[model samples]
Target: MCCALAVPLPVGTAAAIDDQQFNELKDLVTKLGQKIEKQDLRIEQLEKTHAQDAQVHAQDQKTHEQDQRKIQELQQKLEETQQAVSNVQTAAIAVPVEPLPRVPLDEATVNHNFSILGDAEFQYAKTSGQHGTFLFADFAPIFLYRGGEKVLFEAGFDFGLQNNAPNSPGATTTINLSFAQLDYLMNDYVTLVAGDMVLPLGTYSERTAGWLNKIPDDPLPRDLLPGAGVGAQLRGAVPLGESGKLINYSVWGVNGASSADGTGNADQLDLGGNVGLRSDNAVANLHGKPSGGARVGWFMPFKPHYDLELGLSGQSGEWDNAGQHLWSAGVLDASLHLGSTVEVKGEYIRSCYGSDDHGNVRPEGWWLQASYKLVGLNLDWPVINNLELVNRYDSIHDGLGTRTRRYTLGYIYYFSNTLLFEGGYEFLHSNDPTQKDQLIFQLSYGF
Candidate 1:
C-alpha cells in the first residue's frame, strides 16, 4: 500500500510540475508576441517620418529653383533696362545744334573803329577896316586804343568873302585850310607829332590858334613869330632835384612855309625847341596836374600875325633872286603862374633877314602881357558853364612898325568844358592910322 501511494503521488507531482512549466512558456511567448507587434509599429512610424522628410526636402528644392528663376528673370530685366538707359543716353547725345563761328577783326575795322567829331562857326562882323561875314570851322577827332595810347587829329577850314575895297574888286570868297596835324602820345613823359604844329617860340604863339585865343587880335610878339609850320616834334619831361620839380622840353624840325602853302623845296628846314620848368605839384586849370618847371624857347623865320612875312628866307643852292631865301630869327619867352587864376608872361625877339638886296637886316621887338582870371564863378543856368572875367594889357614896339598899345575886355560863355562861345571888345591905338580900332567875335568848340 505504501509503494502504490508513493508512485501515484510522484506521477501527480510530475504532471503538475509539467503543467506549470507549460503555462510559464505560454506566458513568455505571449509577452514576446506583444513586444514584436510594438516593434513593428515603431518601424512603420520611422518609415512615415522618413517619407515626410523627403517630401519637405523636395518642396524646399522646388522653392529654391523658383527663387533662382526669379533671380535670373530680374537679372535679365536689369540687363535690358541697362541697355535701354544706354540707348536713351546715346539718343540724347545725337541731337543736332547750330554752331557759331568765331570771327577775326579786320584792318578796316581797326582803322575805322573810332569815331570822328568836330565843330564849325560862322561869324558876321562889321569893323573899321574889315567888314564881312566869315565862316570858320575846327575839327578835332580823338582816337583811343586798348593799350592806353592816344592820337588827336585836328583840322580847320576858313571861308569868307573879303572886300577890303568895295569898288576895287567884287568881294572874293576864299577857303583856307588853317591847321592839320596828328599828335601821337608815346607816354605822359614823351610825345611824337607831325604836320602843321604850332610854333614853340613863345607862350603866346603856342596858344594863339585862331579858333582858341583869349584875345581877338594876337599879341604883337606872336604876330612876329612864326605861328604854324609842317613839322615833326618830340617832347619829353625830365625830373629835376627833389624839390618836386621837372622840366619839359620840346624839339622840332619843320618846313619854313605853311603846310598848305608849302614850297616844292623839300630841303628847307626850320629848327625850334622849347624848355619849361615848374615846381612840384603844379596844377593847370585846363590841363589838370602839370610838370613844374621854368620854360624857355627859340624859333626862326619870324612874321606878322597873318599874311605878313618880313624875314629873309633863302635856300642853300642858289642866289641872285633865283634860289630860296635864307632867314634866321631868335626868340625868348618866360612865363609863371602863381596859381591857377594868375599868370604873368613876357617875351623878347631878335631877328635878322638876309636878302638879295640887303645882306642882313637886324630887327628887334618885344611885348609884355599880364592877365588875371576870376575863375570861381558859379551861375544858375547851364547857359553859363563857367564864366571867366579876364583883364589884359599889352604893349609892343617893332623896328619896322610903330609902337602899339592895346586893352581888351573879354567874356566867355561855356556850354560845356569843351564847347565855348567867346566875344570880345578890343581898343587899339597904333602909331599907324590904318590899323586903329578893332572889334571881334568868335565861337569855338573842342573835344
Candidate 2:
C-alpha cells in the first residue's frame, strides 16, 4: 500500500474559501489530472509506432544487402565463364587449319598463331541458245594472323583460269592478291589499317566473297570501286542503344584510279607498270594524287530474328593527267533479314568519269537480290530441306545512251557447311535489241 502526504494551506486562505468555490476548484484540478493521463497514453502509443518503423527499416536494409551480394556473385561467375571460353578459342586457333593425317582435329600437334581458310569454286555460264564454257573459276586462300589482342593481319589471293577455246589447249590463267593489310586496334571505337588495304567503297567489295556470295554475276558497272588500294584507314563501330541499334563507319585516303585503271577489281595498271612492282602488283598514283573515300552504315536487330542495315559510300579523286578521267562515285546499299529464312538485299551505285573525250559520262546501276531458305522452315524432308530460292534484278543506265536489264531466278543447295552449289536462268534485255539471255551455274567449297 502507498500513501501521499499534502501540506496544509494557511489558516486565513482556508477561511476565505467558500464551500461552493472549493468544490469548483476541486473539479478543475480533477480535469487537469485527466488531461495529463491522456497525454501520457498518447506519448506511449507514439513510442510503440516508432519502434515498429525501426524494425521494418532494418528488414529492408538486410534485403538490399542480400541482393547486392547476389549481383556480385553473378558478375564474378560471368567473368569466369568468358575467360574460360577465350582460353579455349585461343588454344583452338593456334592449331593448323588443315592438319596432317592421324592428327586429331582437337589435338593437332602443330602450334601456330596463324591459320588459313580458303574457297575453291567452279562455274559454267553462257548466253541462252549459245555456246557455254566450263572452267575451274577461282581458288581463294585467306590468311589470318592474330599478333595480339590489339593487332591483326590478313591477306588473300585469288587464282583462276578461263578457257575461251574448248577445242584448244590454251587457257588464260589469272592470279591476283586481293589484300595484304595490317590492323592495329586503337580502342573499342576505332581501328587503324595500313598497307594494301581493302577499299571500304561499297558493301559488296568487302562482304561478297566466293565463299558466301549469293549470285554468280555482279551488277553492271561493277568498276565503280577498286578492289584494293595502298592506303591508311580509320574505321570504327558505334553503339547506338541497347536494343541492338548500331552504326559502322570508315574513311580512307588511297591511291586514286586513273583512266588506265579498269573497273572494280580490274586494275591492269598493276600488271603493265615495271616500277619495281612487287609480284607485278602496282599501286595507283595518277598525277601524284590520292583518292578519298568514306562509308557509313546504320543497323538494327530485333529479338527472335529480324535485322536491317543501310549504308552509303562515296569516293572522289583525280583520274588522269589531262583531267580526262577525274572520277567520283557513290553507292547505297540495304539489307533485310527475317529469322534467317528470308533476306532482301539491294545496292545502287552511280559513277562519273570526267573524260576530256567523252565529257562527264555518269554511269548508274542498281541490283536487288532476295533469297528464302527452306532449311530454316524445318521441312523435315530428306533432299530439298537444305535448299534456297533466289532471285535478282539488275538495271544499268550507262550515260552513253545504253540501258541493260537482267533478271535471274536461281536455286542454291547446301550439301554441307563447306559446300554450296547454285544455278540460275537469266533473261537479258538490252536497248541494242541484239543481246541474248543466259544460264549460269556455280559451285563452291570452303575449307
- Candidate with top lDDT is 2
Query: Any runs in candidate 2 off by more than 4 Å, and if so which?
Result: 1-111, 164-169, 261-284, 323-325, 432-435
User: Which tens-of-lDDT digit does each residue in 1-447 have in candidate 2?
Assistant: 233346556798676677779889999999999999999999999999999999999999999999999999999999999999999999989976875576333323323668999899899988766789887878999999877667789999999887657898877888888888999999999999987888876777788756677877676656545667777899999999788799999999876665454322212222112122433465434445667899999999987579999999998876664444566889999989888789998889898776544667788999899999888778778677888999999888877787998898999898887898989888888996766888889998989
Error of 2 at 87 (Å): 33
Q: Cα miss at 146, model 1 (Å)? A: 11
TM-scores, in order shown?
0.50, 0.68
Mind giving the per-residue lDDT tens digits that candidate 1 earns over 198-283? Answer: 65655554454454555444666444446555557777666655543556566665544211122322222222211111234432
Give candidate 1 regions above 4 Å deviation: 1-108, 112-173, 182-190, 241-244, 257-326, 369-386, 395-398, 419-421
